[model samples]
Target: MSNYKPIDAKREEFRKYLEHAGVMDALTKVLVSLYEETEKPEDALEYVRKHLGGITESSSNTDALRKELDESQAQVTELKAKLAKFETEAGNE
Candidate 1:
């Protein structure tokens, strides 16, 4: 059904968002380690941001990413519920 397409798309988008989150988390860890070792958080942050394009001087990107990550997670949960319902119905038929 047409409705299924949107769910599928959202699921795929959520997967991408999770992947991005994982990458961001890794970068954060790496930056933290560098900062601790070098005693220069600003330098480490700058290096990390430079290596990972799309991170601007402002915190807007971080906020947006967090929001998108949360939205994606919720969408994935909804998609899973829909999938379970569809599977149950199919099994009953």
Candidate 2:
């Protein structure tokens, strides 16, 4: 005895499409690589994005993000120093 709905049939068709397109094999390789990692990535989505190959965001975009992060960190450090100075001046008053 078995029960299968139209959704199940559609899902089966989609699976076949993926298999035909070699998506399943590509996915399997990425999963295996993830499983074999001695220290798993903090960002699994990024890891998968990298392993899936070629569909990456431009290096220029990543560079821009990195530059923004560095600038933000520098601002934080400057703010911390100013706060520390203010606290010291307040305490002395």
Candidate 3:
């Protein structure tokens, strides 16, 4: 039998969190674009910067983030209400 190791919970949580945030998808697209270049650009840093510079630059995206936060909070409130209803039904059953 082969030894099957369990995934670390924290790392898995973080990966899912990044995926939920679209960070992994964005980075994958940038890396794929870099890989498809026929000839590497003279300034490798510039090439990567051109493709990936905005990944961590949140200062310029504050309004977008605020909108997302508002939407997420609304979703949380909806889910919590659903959960509470389910719990009440379960208790009654």
Candidate 4:
């Protein structure tokens, strides 16, 4: 039949259509961002919307910086405890 085609051929045509629509690039970026997230978003659609809506990088950077600051603060607390223990031991000696 003239209308018959292999599944791979149909898939290739669909891929071409998505590429032509610029969806391939946008989808790739969104997927990469999603994959790199340390804290997976609760609302997947909202995350995708914010990313696709041309929101600036500042928001993402802010999130990363905040997480870094929290981790640093925790490390400082641990170091402080270790220092306190060392001081106590030296005082006993």
- Please provide TM-scores, in order, for all candidate models, with all chains considered together: 0.40, 0.50, 0.48, 0.45
The models' CA-based lDDT, in order, is 0.73, 0.88, 0.86, 0.88
- What residue runs in model 4 are displaced by over 4 Å at the alpha carbon? 1-11, 55-93
Clashes, model 4: 0
Give the per-residue lDDT digits (tens) of candidate 1, residues 1-93: 355544588888887897777865666766666657645555655766654554333467778889999999999999999999999999999
* 10 residues in a row with least lDDT, candidate 3: 51-60
Please, what are the lDDT tens digits per residue for candidate 2 over residues 1-93?
679655788899999999999999889888889989999999998999887873346667888989999999999999999999999999999
lDDT by residue for model 4 (1-93), tens:
499866798899999999998898988898889889999999988889888765446677878989999999999999999999999999999
Residue pairs with colliding backbones in model 2 are none
> Judged by lDDT against the true structure, how good is candidate 2?
0.88
TM-score of candidate 3 relative to the true fold: 0.48
Winner by TM-score between candidate 3 and candidate 2: 2
**Pairs of residues clashing in candidate 3:** none
Better of 3 and 4 by lDDT: 4
Query: Which portions of model 1 show Cα errors greater than 4 Å?
Result: 1-57
The lowest-lDDT stretch of 10 consecutive residues in candidate 4 is: 52-61
- Candidate 4, residue 17: how far the Cα is off, in Å: 1.5
State the lDDT at 12 in candidate 2.
93
